[model samples]
Target: MQFIINGETVEVAADIRTSLLDLLRNYLGFTGTKKGCDQGACGACTVLVDGERINSCLALAVQYQHRNITTVEGLARNGSLHPLQQAFIDHDGFQCGYCTPGQLCSAIGMASEIERNIPSVVTKDLSATSVMLDETEFRERMSGNLCRCGAYNGIVEAISEATVPAAAAKTAGRASP
Candidate 1:
């Protein structure tokens, strides 16, 4: 089967029942997306499927044929770290780093959702035309990804710094100048 991963098209022969995570890590050698739990309960296997985040453990390889698959390795561009990645470093968003890959991907996808004004569970005004990236929204949107090192504060701060505008972040005290 053919898969488009990290802006490259590659073909691999695999079993029909292979999970996307298995296909990525085992077959294609994209080991950045870790396998913390085989089940989707843990967000360690998150990846961007056509710019949207999905739990790769629960997805089948065949189901993503011809679609854009972006792993943590693909987040950088022109040899520069992605903004969120840099933010992660600046804010110490990770410790053991096992969940950093998934957190990065999920945060980027969540930023896109916010750009489109998509409402989350804590969205008080669905008709407000714009969703604020406040604490409630951040917590609710990022609840799925877990960090065993107890780095939730840094993760939230990093995401807020990267996704929220500088002025807004300053107003909310989410990021440094």
Candidate 2:
């Protein structure tokens, strides 16, 4: 089957039943997307499928044919880190680093959700004038991605920092690592 992953189109000679996670790590050699529980419960295999976060382990490779897939590796450009990646680093959002890839990818998608005005379960008012990025909201949105090392505080902080408005970010200055 053919897949567009990280902006590259490639054909893989694998079984039709192969999971996208296996296709990426086993066939395509993109190990950044981890395999934690091998089930959809763990968000370690999260990836952006058409700009929406999905558990790759639960998706069949054949299902993603011609779909745009963004792995954690795709977030960088020209050797510079994406703001979220830099925020992860600056805020120490990782411990063992096994789950960092999924966390980063999910955070990217989470920011998109906020920008699109998608409300989570914790959203108090769907018709609220603005979306507020608070600790409660961050925790509710990121609950799927587990960090066994318990670096959730840092992860929340990183997402908070990365999601700041561009104008605010420009004036606030980058956080120190």
Candidate 3:
């Protein structure tokens, strides 16, 4: 299969049944995308495909031949960490850190999703003048991710208050870590 991963085009030998998580960790040595439960039950395998989040453990690598795949490693550019990564760190969004990568990718995508006016099922007014981020939306959209360390307060705060937005950034900054 041919796909662009982390901005590089690479050809990988994969069958239709090989999950993207396996191809990344076992075949391509990209272990950042975790294999929690291997059943898509957890969001540990979250990765960005065409700028949208996906659970790679449930997706076949061959199915992504035409997709732009971004693992946790791709979140950074040149040498600096992505703003989301830094935000996660500054907000103490993780504990054990096993789920940090997935949480980061999912948070980045979640922010973009909200910015694009994508309405979550919890949205009370789908046609509201503006889409607002709320706890219900966050919970519904990110329900797949499970943090055993129970750092959800920080995790949600970091994502909800990404530094790019001054208002939200202030929220996270003023929030207790």
Q: Give each model's whole-structure lDDT.
A: 0.87, 0.84, 0.80
Q: Give a tens-digit lDDT track for model 1, residues 1-177.
A: 999999999999999899999999999999999999889877999999998999999999999999999999999999999999999999999999999999999988887787777889998878876776677777888888989999988998898788666324323333231
Of candidate 3, the 10-residue stretch with the lowest lDDT total is 168-177
Model 3, residue 63: C-alpha shift (Å): 1.1
The reply for model 2, stretches above 4 Å from the true place, is 164-177
Give the TM-scores of the predictions, in the order they appear.
Answer: 0.91, 0.89, 0.88
Would you list the rank order by TM-score, best first? 1, 2, 3
Between prediction 1 and prediction 3, the one with superior lDDT is 1
Q: Could you tell me the TM-score of candidate 1?
A: 0.91
lDDT comparison, 1 vs 2, better candidate: 1
Q: Which order, best to worst by lDDT? A: 1, 2, 3
Q: How far is candidate 3 from the true structure (C-alpha RMSD, Å)?
A: 3.5
- lDDT per residue (tens digit) for residues 58-108 in model 3: 988888887889999998998998877887888899998999989888877
